[model samples]
Target: MNVTSGQEWVRGQFPRLDWLPDETLFSLCSRQHLVMGNLDPATTSTAVLGLSEKFIKHDIPCGIAALEQNGFHYWGSAESILLHHTIFSVFVPFQNKIKIEDAIITIKGDRIDSLKYRLGLVSSGFGAEHPLKACPYCMREDVDAHGIAYWHLTHQYPGVLICPRHQAWLMVSTKSRRWSGRFEWSLPTKDCLIQQASSQKLWLRPAFLNLANNVIDLAVIGRVMSLESCTVAATYRKAVLQGGRSASLLDRIEPLRRFHLFESLPEDEKSTESFMNQLIRTPRRSI
Candidate 1:
């Protein structure tokens, strides 16, 4: 029960927390905390999540039943929240059906271990740093339209450095504690922008722009269908063949030249041979 104002707790009678379009579950929970005026995070967590000590994860949060019990059921069912409010859509294109089902079952509960591994995120060589990112234009517009700035699930996707709508580089938060701290529920503001990231402009190269658009499209499409590894590899092969290239010719291309194909990738990734191989190889399962 929430200790704020010495109020008695009632099941499913919690304060109204309407869902914002494309807003993350973390952001929704954070806004609830703000509305309740709780000085301690555990107060809000116990009321909203039915847990007193659970950490709020930005990417893949668990305990959907708890959230529903606390009056967020109108936001949607457990599965609905997982697909609409979390980063699960981004992984759907790569994951198999069985894996996706297991993810749904696990996420509906309170367990967190192995979820990343099952989704292939642990092996993807990306998402090593779960930085809280926000597009400045999005923030300003959201404030104007909705009266508050909230986190968008799309902005937090791995390798998504630019805002698909604004074509502006997303600003990463400089304060780790803002998102990582047990009690902090900081929102986007110009003051939160990382110093170096604030000074930089979007990389407007054609390849960079194309990759950003394709990634956003895939994430949106993944909500309905799974693009299995075999289908993806087949598409690549078809594209190569249509371009008057063969397997042998592709194999003969020098490694540096292959690396050049992904020149827009982060420098750290280009320097890692295993990461490069993973990107180009047709994987047996999820990549």
Candidate 2:
């Protein structure tokens, strides 16, 4: 029940604001909060969080419920954008190797929803610290077209450091809170840009740029959830073979030279080895 002006205590039902295309659930929820008039983001979020089931960690459960009520399709918002899109795409080598459908089931299954276990919660390698990224061009374009800037579905994914359309490096906003605590949904603005990026090395490689775009394609347009892990691994092997960057050959290459041969990219341009150290473990099934 949203306490804002006694706006009907409809359990499991949420009010729908005019949601922006590719808007994050966080951003949409934030907008909903603001519409209640004069409510600060924190207070508004707390109000919405009150509607969710106890086990739901992030605001996603209620956020999805609200969006679902509003007639937005379920898969793109919840599974593709808000959930494990980052790890499934860029962070994992050979995206084709992932059993995306099974992975989706595992994440959204009753086991997780029931609060029975926290199996994939900490994607330490992929989810460590991707700064809140936005392309300035995309923001300006949104303001021009939609009249309000909102987080893009593509921009929110962790490994995506470039805007697929703009081809410019996405600027990292210096937000008030870190990733875990950042429930304050914000749209990109000129004010949010880090002035240091112009002088600093924040750019991404073309290969990575293409890969990020491909990941988004897989996420939004393609039906990749049906892929099997063996198929995924096989695809990876093919790429490696075609690349001719066998492990034995890679050993003789220099550090910078070896990078191209390896399918893995550092989580960010400035990522340290220790930060990207964790392995993508194989899924365990119940007996």
lDDT of each: 0.68, 0.48
User: What TM-score does candidate 2 reach?
Assistant: 0.60
Give me the runs in candidate 2 sitting further than 4 Å from their true place: 1-6, 9-16, 46-63, 66-124, 176-183, 195-205, 221-226, 247-287
TM-score of each: 0.78, 0.60
Judging by lDDT against the true structure, name the best candidate.
Answer: 1
The lDDT of model 1 is 0.68
Candidate 2 lDDT over 1-287, as tens digits, reads 34953444442254556557766555665566655553455555445433333323322233433334334444355555434322334322323333444444544432334211222323323343345567888888888997777666577565466688887767766662254354454556778666324533533357557656766765553434334445554665565567544343333222323232222534332342222122222323320
lDDT of 1 at 195: 31
| Model 1 Cα shift for residue 19 (angstroms) | 1.6
